[model samples]
Target: MKPTSSLVWLRRDLRVFDHVALHQALQDSAVVHCVFVYDTTILDALPRRDRRVDFIHASIAEVAAELAELGGHLIVRHGDPATEIPALAAELGVGAVYCNHDYEPQALERDATVARTLRDAGRRFLSFKDQVIFEKSEVLSQTGGVFSVFTPYKNAWLKKLDADPSVLAPYHIEPHAARLAPPPSPAPALPTLAELGFEPSNLAELNIPTGMSGAARLFEDFLPRIAQYKDARDFPALKGPSYLSLHFRFGTLSVRHLVRTVRDVMARGAGGEGAPVWLAELIWREFYAMILFHNPHVVGGAFKPAYDAIQWETGPEADELFAAWCEGRTGYPLVDAAMAQLNQTGYMHNRLRMVTACFLIKDLGIDWRRGEAYFALHLNDFDLASNNGGWQWASSSGCDAQPYFRIFNPITQSQKFDASGKFIRRYLPQLKDLSDKEIHAPWLVPRMLPLDYPGPIVMHDEARKLTLERYEMVKKPGPSADQ
Candidate 1:
């Protein structure tokens, strides 16, 4: 039976078009109302000034404006989603409340509470897979178990896509536009940053785009260079990345749309290696999501339980080192510069993310969780699963992680990727006057040593040895030991 009235609850999937929950609600109801909640449970824990909050606020405004044009008004509420969603659904007398899935543990718990409350009221709470292409146990191994590694999982993902290409099809909502319901009363204004207990961030000055239009603008710019993604993606100085992570994180853009576009380009042989490489990245995201879903313990512990036994640096010295790393005062040009970019823009290049993360775990010998939490607080595109997976990968405590024995040489990495020192110079202007050769390690050039830049925090050679010893403690016993 069709519902006389249904409510569509918008979460990360912020856009109007190609949205599963919205389409589903419109399909089953004569009248559909849209809503977005500023969940204070999540917000109260964050700092007063956050770029993500600003970005979300701006995007919600866009959603409200767009919905108004579509003959519907968005109901913006500020409260715990668990209470707010059920309360709103009851007030609207909705037969069902539709929303997209959220994979995070906290979100799952919150949803469970909302579901119970809605069920008690005799209203249905329905959620659809709208974030990733495949979720939970969707793309399991042949043995019917969740795959831990990425490559095999990626292969399975590709095969599944090949077999069922319809998975990438967009959920067109325009046809059901006539079902949208106007606001019950005057549309409540979106809460201001101050009203929400958050100060204005530099998101506007950074010019990082927001909303569907902003996402489209970025995608249009990225399409031309996607063919070169494989070769250009590694160098931090170049405009290589799609810069759509924020869009993806917030669901301002649809994953299906991106995958479909890339798949079409690959079929035409226009994407070259870049298309497949970029597609693999998208798969990596799903892989992490699957990891988090299957192994929820990864939120607080290592994927390989044995890695938890490895002791990290402690006491005042360790805290001092971590502070240096966070402040961009570590004196390793590449690592420090990467931190500076993250602190200033709330964005860091992919290559730098690896280098910096490796430096934190391998060089500083600090706990990966510390760095992970720091990133969770700062990164505008912070998705818990991906961020946690990345930190674990760098710490050699994750599935398919880099071997602990193979530590990165910070100087060589800087020299190789930022060979011309363009990226370093951009972030670390103190070394701007130095030549490319000298910019990589200013300490090596005695004349440049005493410049504004601090000296190397710790000798790489010594740190590498310390890291090897630390990891050795967790090494399995040799054959002789058993004898």
Candidate 2:
């Protein structure tokens, strides 16, 4: 007898708790099966020992173990999910496949193929919004056009949440356990790392545990600092920003639950300005996702078409400059420190991200895409939308992005943000001996005697003047004498 079952095709959403798609699947079917595909299309392009891949694998294993405790097992596979999902569904005689929505262009195409396959097999394909609080048209300008800017979009998002109390309600899944299928007769074997052409990575050393257990640790730790986030988030040496970005990226943590808790604190006036500002950053995440949904071209080019025509430095000189930036030898203390942080930890402070990005395009005169690609490759929490949005924002090619002429003065930024040099000392240990004032720009110290420590590679004033000359070719006449 064919079992009337449903399959939850897990993608980014790795956890069963507070998952909308899983709840709906369990409610709509008598028996539910959860599965995750290690999509080869994405994996094949990654390095052999990618931490993100390892993190996902570990998270999925935990999901499988957790589901087994609830009398169901996670069926894991490696290949194109479009073909694999339908095959699993048909083989199990399931009637529907439920999944969380993905906004990336590649994901959209993959989901379409999977949907068609499920339909051909006389099965249903349903996707739920589980990762983000507001997506696509849920928040729009009064003019009926999508908001290209961040502030207005953030304002509209806040208003919508204010209007609808139920929008932040959690999707309870615990009660639907009975609907999950009893463990299969012969449990499917999980593929080993070698089987998937990947090797073990330093995920454990980074202390970024995977799955629900890790998210719990991160959340508990972050709650205490949530109030001080606005004050400390810019300082890379301080533990301010929630380390939960990777968990959020993979949906191990529930977006609705986060918003509800934060919103409640905001209502009670507990989290202070930190709550709203941090919440705005989260909204910015959704805004970038919506931007990609509407204007996919921003992945490769500028969001504003006119900005695309701007010339960028190229050839061997550009290559050398790019190499210097990548190697953390840019001579700018903050920029070098930020690059080191990224290379060592697969993370960069949000402020440093802006600083390094501006330095790359505005100061180094290189194309923004080069830096974007490097971030994409290095950041553990790298989401395509956020990475592209950040690069565009720095280059002034994106809506609501920083203006091109308003370039970041790296030395001034270091002095202001990392005045104590705590962040710089942590990453670039050679500068640890210098005093707070001298640490920001080591070469300027009156009594410099450190033979090993290299001095500033490029003078700030010279670089700034050269950058202005480079940008003048594309920069329009403006009110300020600086432009």
TM-score of 1: 0.97
Which of the numbered candidates is closest to the native, going by highest lDDT?
A: 1
Which candidate leads in TM-score? 1
lDDT of 2 by residue, 284-303 (tens): 99999999999999989999
What residue runs in model 2 are displaced by over 4 Å at the alpha carbon? 1-3, 446-457, 479-483
Each model's TM-score?
A: 0.97, 0.95
Candidate 2 global TM-score: 0.95
Clashing pairs in 1: none
| lDDT computed for candidate 2 | 0.85
lDDT of each: 0.91, 0.85
